[model samples]
Target: MTTKINRHLTWQRMCACMATCAMAIVVACPIAGFASVQTASADDTANTVSTIIVRDGMLSRYTQLGGAQGILRQPLENEHPTANGGAEQRFQGGTLFWNPSLRGSYLVRDGMLSRYTQLGGPAGRLGLPCADELAVPGGASQVFQGGTLFWNPSLRGAYLVRDGMLSKYAAARYEQGPYGLPVSDEYAWNGGARQDFQYGSMFWNVSDWWKYSSQGPYPNLAGVSNLNVAVSIASQRVYIRDGERVLYTMITSTGINDWTPRGTYRINGRGPSFYNRNEAMGARNWVRFIGNFLFHSVPIDSSGNYIVSEAWKLGQPASHGCIRLTVADSQWFYNAIPDGTLVSIW
Candidate 1:
């Protein structure tokens, strides 16, 4: 009618420009895929938040930034990229970390909390140094020589070293004792007091009055009786034993130190006495044993020569502290030690 209505208005303006170019390619393909999925979901919600409260709330709201007064908004803070990125902060105010399975690396700074390690990567080095100062107290047990702190006086516990020594739960807790005796190959007598013997090489056996019964291993004779007989300040050289056989061979001289007085006294009195040098000492012949001390013999040196000598000082520790023997070794130590014998002295 007007050409067919202007050709139906150009054909409806080409069909409304082809429906506005198909709605501009369907809204630019979803706004460029929703702006690349909203920029990858806001970079994954800023990497899942907490980088130590986002670096302490961005250094407490940027006291300054680009100019660098407070700096670090995110140079790095609690990173941990896969398992190796390593980071966990608090910096100028304590707590810092790295620890990729103890490949180690930490820092707390002025409030103390140091640690470092890395010599080969994958976290492998650090045999020492790296806390950047403040070591002092013998510089960490001298770079781990004292082995990183210890006290263990037999597991009273308090140890912590690593790789160098002690750390199997502190050497398995503790249980130590028996350190005094052990050297027996079987002579079976056990008696103990460090196998007692008064004078060197070992010998003790005496009976009759100045008692101390048995002990003898003389010059390696090894007749082993465990030992415990000691007397020398003149209790008449008694050391005796003729039964179990151990004998240091000698006896007879007692009583004179102001009439016998020096503490330990025994052997009350035995038989056979006669030569009497004012009762004994010099040939009381055979006065088996007696107390207040006496097994006599005196005048050993102005040489009136009354022989039977092992001569332990001739004024002989001055008698009454008696033990002077020689009359046939005091009749074989009163016929070989008997009555309750056990003597000890300083």
Candidate 2:
């Protein structure tokens, strides 16, 4: 009986050892290999075993196991108020879809989201009912419309706003005086105010003694005659038969060479008797016209005659192309001649 009992005890010990060896082999194998075996297990009891064990974070575990590849793990509930409110779902190939309560589902390609319906709501406001762009008026100032600011088809100037009033600068306001009429003191003082005057009526402000033509009523001299008798270089003598008779006749030196031009000229300027020491002589009331050329009196010698000294004469056409006359003759010419009187030369 004792022997039989010992045999039963040894058999029990052997069975226990065999069970421990099987447990050790299972623990020694790699966890990945063991997991694969568990997943591939065909037995209904082994199939219930999960390969991935859930640990601390349940949400993280759910994402790793339950989420589809290339898709959003959770629904997007956070967005700006201006943005369309919805839960955004992501799919493979980076596609996004919006699911809203009021609006139907929409597909988002790239970064833009477009509605699927053409209903009379926010979608209609996009293009059909709303303008492509909006414009705001600048300020309380003037608003320019279809035409130009100062919409005159022909006229041009600034359209200004001053003291809350609209005004224009134009060429029809402060007009110029008529021909032969004196310019007003106001217009002459304030030249800027005359910019809007009549175009042809304006005349330049010349010296006090200067006068413009009246017979021709033009700036240029044409068939006009002198108010008094005048001499020409070509004739070398006063031509008084055409108008007033000569009071006296005197010998005068005319311009030499072609330096003196022949034309109908006006006595534009005059001055009192002055000495030109460079020519070593005294002149009276030297009349200047057509550049530096002048009509003046030259010094005479002791014989009571005009001196034609070599220094006074440049031989290459002397008198600097001016008419040299006696002092008495020059004084008479100056007092008798008017500013705009025509002086003819052949």
Estimate the TM-score of every prediction: 0.17, 0.28
Kindly give the stretch of ten consecutive residues in candidate 2 with the minimal lDDT sum. Answer: 139-148
**Model 2 — TM-score against the truth?**
0.28
**Once superposed on the true structure, which residue ranges of model 1 sit more than 4 Å away at CA?**
1-85, 98-160, 164-169, 172-346
Relative to the unseen true structure, what is the Cα RMSD of model 1?
Answer: 29.0
- In lDDT terms, how accurate is model 1? 0.32
lDDT of 2 by residue, 1-346 (tens): 1121111222223222221231121111121212212222233233122122211222232244343332333222222122234333332222232224333332332212222121112222221111111121221111111111211112322121111111221121211111111112113312222211111122223221011111112122233353543655543443322255433333345666656666767777888755555755555567875566667665443343445462233112345467655455566556655565566656
Model 2 accuracy (lDDT, Cα) = 0.34
Worst 10 residues of 1 by lDDT: 25-34
Clashes of each: 34, 2
The numbered model that scores best in TM-score is: 2
What does candidate 1's lDDT look like per residue over 1-346, in tens digits? 1111111122222222211221121101110111211223323432121212233322322223321223322222333322244544443344344444544444333312232221222243323222323332222211221223222222232222333222321342211111111111112133312222121111112212122222233233245454323344433344443343434633333444445444443444455443435634333323333344445443233234544343333323545455665444445445444444444432
